[model samples]
Target chain A: MKIRVNGEGVQLKQPIQTVEELLHHLNLEKKSLIIEHNHIILKKDQHRESQVSDGDQFEIVHFVGGG
Target chain B: MLSDNRYHRQMLFEPIGEAGQRSIQESHVLIIGVGALGSSSSEMLVRAGVGKITLMDRDYVEESNLQRQQLFSEEDVKNQTPKVIAAKNRLQAINSHTIIEAKVIDVGVEELDSIAEEVDVIIDATDNFDTRLIINDICQKYRKPWVYGACVASYGVTFTVLPDETPCLQCLMDHIPNDGATCDTVGIISPAVQMVVAHQVTEVIKLLTDNQDALSGKLIAFDLWKNQQMELKVATLKDENCPSCSQAKYPNLEYQAQVKTAVLCGRNTVQIRAGTQKNFHFIQFKEHLKDLNLTNFFSNPYLVSFEIDPFRIVVFKDGRTLIHGTKNPQEAKKLYYRFVG
Candidate 1:
């Protein structure tokens, strides 16, 4: 299934079911990540329960250190 | 004293009209860490005619900083002028009317408390999480608004935290853990710093000019090289149990009471503020250095820079020592104690 990540479309190898799984696939599960799935802020607890579908947009951001 | 028509072009803008210009002129902004972001944002604030700008930075100017740090020059690097002093010197030249204050001390909880409450807004121009978290905690305690911004490589991110209204940095701290690249590791471009500064200074203008409603409530991010931009809405990110904003328990403030030692992110420098040496005699210390056979060193009115092979130790009047050539706080502490003790 193809899912939009940060405005770019990416295809999942398997049918990824949840936001937590997507984070795992992206190897960012352990990261302190704030995910916006379908334009909604998904809390950390909701990552496990929130389901992802094909063509859904996600905006993921984490703080970068510098200045 | 602002000359009439000095800010005529800026006053022409609709939002910051004559009244807003006066508001801008009457405002006082405290910017921490006069690095790329600090120098750039402070410049915009100064040019926009902010009444008073107090710049705080511990590090001195280096040749590497001139690429993005707009205020410094070869002369500043030659003299090893502190970042805040160099930035203030340039800022004062741009607009003689604006009051540019410079503090060369390393920022800690005690330093923040002394000035945070008085400023209209605080800009996070620091390069490390420890400093930013401290700024976050202190801003929460004083109930003052602060703009959070960071950039590395070709990417930048920023958000404004309005104490009670928005999710403070502590609330988002866990989610935004320190795992990204740094300027020293991946290197940084001028555009990344400029992008973040644009947002930071804009937030400052909105806060000062009574246009708080126009402030961007989203977490703005940019990847200049990849041409990516994201403004993530973070209303739900506010943790009600946050010790910083919710509980009025500023745990970061307690840090000042402890022994202060921190790695100045990516700078290959460690600052150790072990104890206060109220009456530090530079001439006596220079004589002491000579006795120890430490030959390569320089001393100015502000600090004594001593080089002992790999490490260049800069001793301040108050026993604060910046040990360059090592990033280890423990090593820095060891060297500091060996010398200062």
Candidate 2:
């Protein structure tokens, strides 16, 4: 399955069921992460239950500290 | 009317035409942190005819700040001038017509609550989420707009918060500790500061002039070195039960009111403020400092500064001590208790 992440296309060998699975597949730490799926932000608790599909758009924002 | 042709070029920009320029001239902004982003954005706002600017910063200028903190100079470092004072001096030279209020006080919730009330807008030039979260809550509680900006290494991120109309910082990030990337951990470049400043200043102007349609209602993050960028629409991120916006709880304000310790952003410095007000000056600690065999030290009426190997310590008149060389609060507090206490 293929999906877009931060404006880039990514292909997954195994299908990802939810945002949580996608993050696990990509090896991204869920801490300090704000995920936007289809232009909607999913609360951290909601990520596990939220599902993802092919061609779905995702914007993963990693918060940084500095001025 | 403070009529002047100095802003004639800015008046030509249709979005901020003659009326908008006048509105900009009448708008007041409070900028916390006189570091790189704060210095750059304040300069732009002043140049764009911002009427009044209040700058709040706790630390003084240092040699290392010259690279990216634009307004500071060698003289500022040599004199150990506070960041707000140095920036105020340069900003006044840039536009004498704009009123620049310089504050060299450590910003806490109480300080911010009162100061944030007096300004039309606030700018987040700070390097830590501790203060940013406080500013977010205060702005939300009062319904004042604020533009949040942060940068580290070669990357930067920015977002604007309009109280009732949009989601807030708390609504976006669920964690207290950020991604842990800081200028202290990985050194920063000038472009990262400028890029973030560009977005922040643009939002400040748009908010001040009531250019609502022109506002970028998206969260922008970019990595200049990696050639990566993201502008994500975050309007839908607003949580119905958001503590800051929806319920209007303003949690940070109450939580950080009595808090004293803070890590100076990107400086590897930790600041600890005394619980109660106490008079402190160089003369009071001169003999004690000498007894410690610290011959390498300097004392001024305002602050007593000394160096002990890796750390440079500055103790202010208000019993506020800034220990430069460590970001750990406990470590800094240990050093403070050993010497300044």
**TM-score of each candidate?**
0.94, 0.90
Off by over 4 Å in 1: B290-293
Among the numbered candidates, top TM-score falls to: 1
Give the alpha carbon lDDT tens digit for every residue of B110-190 in model 1: 788888878999999998888888998999888899999999899899999998889988887574455546898889999
Model 2's CAPRI class? medium
Which ten-residue region of model 1 chain B has the weakest summed lDDT?
B172-181
Clashing pairs in 1: none
DockQ of each: 0.69, 0.62
Candidate 2's displacement at residue B202, Å, is 1.1
Each prediction's Cα lDDT score? 0.85, 0.85
Best by DockQ: 1
Q: Which ten residues in a row have the lowest lDDT in candidate 2 chain B?
A: B275-284
* lDDT (tens digit, per residue) of candidate 2 on B313-333: 888767789888998999889
